[model samples]
Structure formats: structure tokens, C-alpha cells
Target: MENPIINVKNVSFRYERENVLENIDLSIPKGSFLGLVGPNGSGKSTLLKLILGLLKPQKGRIELFGMPISKFREWDRIGFVSQKANSFNTGFPATVYEVVASGLTKKIGLFHFMDKKMKEDVISAIHSVGMDPFIHRNIGELSGGQQQRVFIARAIVSKPEILILDEPTVGVDVKNVQAFYEMLDKLNKQLGITLILVTHDIGTVTNKVTHVACLNKFLHFHGDKEEYEKLEEKDLSSFYQFDVKVLSHEHN
Candidate 1:
């Protein structure tokens, strides 16, 4: 009920030769979890990139916390975990502590050294994500699940109020995916951090996230879980053009 933390008004985006997203509008409240779902090439990642200010919108405006994203100065308040984190080489020669500490680079200001408080914050973040034992271990030595957690620690080290992730579960094992989602849910429910996740796991995410934003080259639907639940299989089949239903755990 608070003013929307993120607002997209008639926004549009396109690549070099094609229009990928059309006049899209969205509003996300603070302390909420929103899942963006759609088939491949649906502009889900593009939208997230726009929010992160990686790409400029072709038309319209995007506001964070009621101000134009361009004017917003609280970059540290938001955290981002991209799919690229999974591919980061473990042989990169960095410790988990160092990786997490990098998140405080911004807050430490330009050219400043890491202080005691920053180190403590990084350690706390690592512990929060259950990666304390591996804090001193080499990043490359960790498993895929452990690596993902380190990235999560990096994001949380900044103590961000909102966290956004793109395809976080991609390339991870089934058990690790569950662990990752559990961490996300904990951050949302216990820490009250608003979360926006762009993923293809509709069945799993739909049940966990507080809200849903379905996209397909445009904003198809953005509403609560109850609304998504009311949707019939036939309605979803039309969008997917095939049998569609939340995948059961048994199927996974």
C-alpha cells in the first residue's frame, strides 16, 4: 500500500533492428516479491536491464521510489545478481571474502580502502547466506551452489533494500535451486527485502513470489498470486501454445 517502489510508465525498448518491448507499464510495491515470466525472447531480461539503467528506454519513463531512475541516487539500496555469476571462473584467484567485500566498493567511496566496518559487513553477509565456513576458501574451489551463494552474499553485503535477479536458477542443480529459492524467500519474509526475479520456473516461483508480472513482448499481466491462480490451464496454454500448468515437485 506504500507508494510503488518501482513505476514504469508507457515504457518501450528495442534492439538494433527490432522492437523487443512495447509500451509497458508496471508498479511494484516496496517489500514485495515480483516474478517476471514469459517464453524465450520475451524481453524479460531487457526489462530488468532497463531497471538497472544498463539500457535506455526507447520511450516513456521508469521511476524508482517515485523519482526518475536517472535522478535516483540510492544505488546501494538495490542489489542485482545476474546469470553471469554462474560462469565466473573459480580460477580467478579471489577468496569468497574478497568477492563479497567487493560489494562495498561503492559505499567506501572513490579510491578509499576497505575499512573494518566494511569487512565486518561482508562477513555478516556471507554468514547470512550460510557461506561463513567457505569465506576464506577460493571462489573457484566452491561448487555451483556455493558459488551462487557467494554472489548472493556479494549483493547482500551492501545491505540493499531491494534485490533483483535474472535467471538465478539457471544451470544450477535441482537441490541447489531449492536452496537458492529458500534463501530468497528468507530474505523477503524475514529481512523484508523487496525482490524482483526474472525466471522461467513459473510453477515454483508463482507459489513463492508475492506477485507476478507475465510478459510477452509487452506487459501481459501483473497481479497477485491469487489472480494467477484463477487463470485456467486453457488460458495459459494460449500464451504458451502448449500444455501449461505449474510443474509438480514430482515432475521435477
Candidate 2:
């Protein structure tokens, strides 16, 4: 078996004298599409931040790519799109190509020109998200769904091993959400990128992910999709402290 790409052992976090997460343990292997579902204030975002090395846990440990997060300096291996991504200023005034290329600025450095290979990489990333035609268009002119794709293109431009998105479909139109997920499925299966999605669309996401993690200050359940599907809706509702539903569907 392959080593876990992300490992969390007995992790705990607190904020303003309140515990957000308690004794959480999780392991994610390569090529896994893990969906994190929970109600408001369940610490789902907190956990993602911890794994991304943005916040330190008060107790226990976290490892990324087989190395302790504290010691993991190869940040390019992970790509993150936060919940606020949908709120980005549509009037930011930048072309899709320029926005995608900006993802490499950290590696390319400031005051440096983009060479031929770098430009080619940017184009390839745009194409991967099916945004090649919009490459020369201003980002502000694109629709919400198109803009989200641009953000995803930016995230994957570096060829990261993992992609983490928090509520990526929040503001997207309902009709476009399915297409967005299909694009993600391609990125996962075709590009071989591990995915960790934090979403509230539990009913819809369950059918698309390989694994499901139910969280509410602590891990209520973590298992394969088949096992998750076997669980009763009432049980899931009980864990969430409210009524919950898991809709079933066929994946294309």
C-alpha cells in the first residue's frame, strides 16, 4: 500500500476558549477523492487550514506528503482554493492567462520574465480546465462558473500532487454545478491529483467522492463511500444534531 498523503493523529484545536476540533484522526491515501461534510461551525475549514499549514494545532500532529507539516517546505506540491475564492473581485482587471500564470510567481520570482516553457505550462493548465479559448479574455468578463474554472486552472498550474477546495461551488448556478464537478472528476481521474473538498452539498457530493468524512467538532465517521452509503440517514442526522439527507445517484 502507498503511504498516506495526509495524516492527522489525535489533533485538537481551540479558539477563544472554545474547542473547535477534538481528538480527530484521519489518513488520506493518494488518488483519493475525499469529501468533508458538516454543518456550520463544525471545524471543517479549521481542519483544512491545519493541513495546509496555515494554522497550528494545539495538540497532536499532522503530516503532509510523509513529512511532518511543520517540516514540510515543498508547498508547491499542494494547491489550495479557499472559500473566499468565489468572492474574488470580478473587476480585478486581468486576463485568464495572466491570472493562471500568477500561480507560478512564487517559483519564478519577482522581476523575472516568463520563458517559453513557463508560458507553455500556463497554456496547458488553462486547457486542462477547458479554458483555453478564454485565455486572452479578461477574467472579469467570465461568468461565475467560468471564473471558478479559472481559479482551478490557477491552482493546478503548478502540477501539484493534491488540490484542496473549500466550498468551491457556493455561488455557482445550480445548473452549472454538475459540470463543475465533472471537471473535477476529470482532474482527479485523468490528471491523478488527490482531491480534498470541503462542501455543504452533502447530498450531491456523496455520489461523486470516493470517501466521506462526517465532522462535528470531532470525526463522527470516516470511511469508504460504499460504507458511508450503508449508513442510515437518521444516524447521520443524529451525528449532525439535525435532519440530514444523502441523495443517491449514478456517476457518469
Candidate 3:
């Protein structure tokens, strides 16, 4: 991959005496939707933290947008929506527009007013996620899947080049899960945003993401979706070294 957007080279990390990651090397290209799948305690979250610049690797180097992560200060170019967003307080009195608009705090300043252009950006983001009708509704009143869309709108309101989601569909109903992924597909394909989704639903996400990467303190596989689809269930079982049978789902 020439000038990959995210580059992790010979990266290793540890917490106390427990080695969390070992000689991990991964590269993500721009405009590629990567499904990062792994079992619990497989260092999936840790790798995300490293990529987000929240944690530094103990060994090796990380570069974002071809710049060393340590020197990379374009934080706004990367947006992240955490799994905790699904657990937001239901009683919080914030409207969908208000919640999404908050994402511009860094750009607009905490106390600054949103100019006409900034407000349009917020509305555009909401519309992009198909949440225009619910723009004025209370976030807590929306369904789990709807709330996730609002959160995604907030993340993309900044017009980030890369959007990273950690277990985004945790609280969504099974019926709405597929629609949520379809929306993500639109974001990756139409909007041309690079996406790195950390998820446990290997079976479901593989259907949407362009690439697949399996991690278990080590990278067992990293390739296009077609290549990943070619792997046998037994191979995935060995990669996880735990329990993560990739069950096939019936999608419409």
C-alpha cells in the first residue's frame, strides 16, 4: 500500500508483565472500510487506542497520514465514536441537532456561536445519516439504531478523513443492525471516508467492510474482504485461539 493512511510497524505493547501485543504490523489505506474483528481481550481495543494517539506503543512506530504519530497534530482529521455513546444518558435534555453540533467545539470554540456555514455543516451531517426528520427530537427518545446514527453524524460533522468506531452496534436491535451497516457502507463509499470499525460481529461486518483484519495480540490476517472470505472457519478459529466462530447471517 503506497502511503497508507494508518501505518503500524513492528508495534509491541505491554501492561505490567502481561504482553498485550507482539510485533504487530498493520496498514490501512485511505477510503477503505476495515472490519477489525477479534475475541474479547484480543488487543483490538488496545490497537485502536494506539491508532487514535491515546496510547503510545512501547516498541515500533505509528504514523497517521504519513506523519509520525508523535508529531501528528491534525487531531481534527480523525474522528472517533466510542461504544459508550450507545449508553448515553436517556434523560439528558439534548436534541439531535444540539448533540451533533457539539462536535465542532474545537473548531467553533466552546463559547463561539455557529455561523451560517457551520450550522449547515451540522444539518448536512445529520441528513447524511438519514436523521433529518429527527433533527429536533430528543436523542434519548430515539431508538438504539437511530441514536447510533446521530452519534455517527456527530463524528462526521467534523468532516474527518478517518472515522473510527469501537463496537458501534452494541445496543442496536438485531433487526436494525443491518440497516446500520448499510448506512456505514454509504459513508465509506459515497462520502469517501476511511473507516476502521472495531467490532465483535465478524459474521455481520464482513458483509459491508471492504477489508478484514483479525487480531489476537498478533495479526492473524489482514487483506481484502474477498481474501478474508476465502479463509476456512477452522483458520479463523486458530487465529482467534479462542471462541469466535464466524456464523453466516442471512441478509436481504
Candidate 4:
């Protein structure tokens, strides 16, 4: 069998003087949607940054697409939708099309201009996230969920093979949260884009991701939903250091 799309070996990281991640090892198969879950202060975001090469690990190595992360020059292969990135003033006068078009900067490079095909691709990506109706609207003027969709469109505009999302549904309403996950499901299934999501939205994401990685300064547990079923509620509570109720309806 071939290696996974993403492979981390004995990785650890520190911030300033404190250790954030320790002895982490995992392999994420291609096209898998993974949910990284943990309580506050747990190195969830730090792990994502390490994978993105924003931060170098203090130990071990990370590989993407079967190559060292440092050697991967094709940045367009990975897309990122940061949490709270849409909270910036949508009222800043940039239209939705402009916002989405900005993501093509890497693919087109800095010196050249966006050609006709690139523009069409931007529009197509926006439509993929169901934000076509607001293509010309000022990004700041849209609601939270709409703004999130616009950011997602920006990510997809590059046609990335992998998508990394950090709390993509924050500040959205219940109905929109459902819509957001549905859109994610569509993107993963229809586009075959691998998704790695960092979120605290347990109930909503438990059933959505193909695999789950629970982290809190250390690897707590990671596997499919069935493996999670084998864990007792008390054990989970102990791992989290708080009361946790695994809802039957949601997990089922």
C-alpha cells in the first residue's frame, strides 16, 4: 500500500519555554476528513501550523504528498480557511469577487496579472461554496456565515487538493452551521479534497469527519468512530479533565 497523504513522525513543538506538543505520530490518508479536537490551550492550532510549515518542529519530521514539508514548493496544493479570518471588516470596500480573487496570487505569481481563465475559476469557486448570489456584494456587509462562505470560496479558488480549516463555523447560527457542514461534506465527496479541521464543535463534527484526533498537549486518542465507541464516558471525562457527555443521537 502507498503512504498516507500526510505523515508525522515523533513530532514535538514548544512555544517560548513551554512544550505544546509531544511525541506525536500519525498518518492521514488521502481524501480523509479529520477532526482535531481538544480543550483550550491544547496544541490544536500549533499542530496545524506545523503541518503548514509556519512553525518548525522541535523534533521529528512532517511530510506532505510524500515529500518533506520544507521541500514542497507547490503551496497551491493546500488551502487554508482560518478561523475568525472573516471577522475582519467586510466593510473594507472589497467585493466578494475581489476577496476570492486574492487567493490566486500564489498560482498567478506576484508579477503577472490574472488572465480570463483565472477570473472564471474564481467565479466557479465562489459558486461551489453557494456564494454566487453575493459575488458582487461588499464582503463586510454580509452576515457571518456569508463571510465564512466567501473565505471558503477564496480557499477553493486555487483548486487545492487539501483543505485545512480552523473553526470554520464560528459565530454562525445553528441553521448556518448545518449548512456549513453540508457544504464541507459536499466539497470532500464531490471534489475529493482532503480536509483537516481544527474545531471545538464536538457534537456537530463527530459524525462528519472520517477520523478524529483528540489532543491536549499529548495524543489522547485517535481512530475511527467505532473506536471511540469502545471508550467509556468516564474515561473520556478523565481525558478531558471535565464532564463530557457523548450524545447517543449525535455519535450514532
Q: What are the lDDT scores of the predictions, listed in order?
A: 0.85, 0.90, 0.92, 0.86
Residue pairs clashing in model 3 are none
Error of 4 at 27 (Å): 0.9
Report the C-alpha lDDT of model 3 over 110-173, residue by residue, as the tens digit. Answer: 8889999999999999999999999999998998788889999999999999999999998889
Deviation from native of the Cα of residue 150 in model 4, angstroms: 0.7
Candidate 2: tens digits of C-alpha lDDT, residues 1-252 = 369999999999999899999999999999999999899999999999999998999999999989999999999999998754468797898999999999999989988989999899999999998998899999988887888889899999989999999899877888878878888989999999999999888777766789989999999999988888889999899879998877643446
- Candidate that would win on TM-score: 3
lDDT of 1: 0.85
Q: Where is model 2 more than 4 Å wrong at Cα? A: 248-252
- The number of clashing residue pairs in model 3 is 0
Taking all chains together, each candidate's TM-score versus the true structure is: 0.93, 0.96, 0.97, 0.93
Q: List the residue pairs that clash in candidate 2.
A: none
lDDT: which is higher, 2 or 4?
2
- Residue range 1-252, candidate 4, lDDT tens digits: 278899988999998899999999878899888888888889999999999999999999999999999898888899998876446775588999999999998778878889999999999999889998899999888888888888988998989999999888787776667778878888999999999988787776666678888888888888876676678878777767888887632421
Report the poorest 10 consecutive residues by lDDT, candidate 2.
243-252
Model 2 TM-score (2 dp): 0.96
Candidate 4 backbone overlaps, count: 2
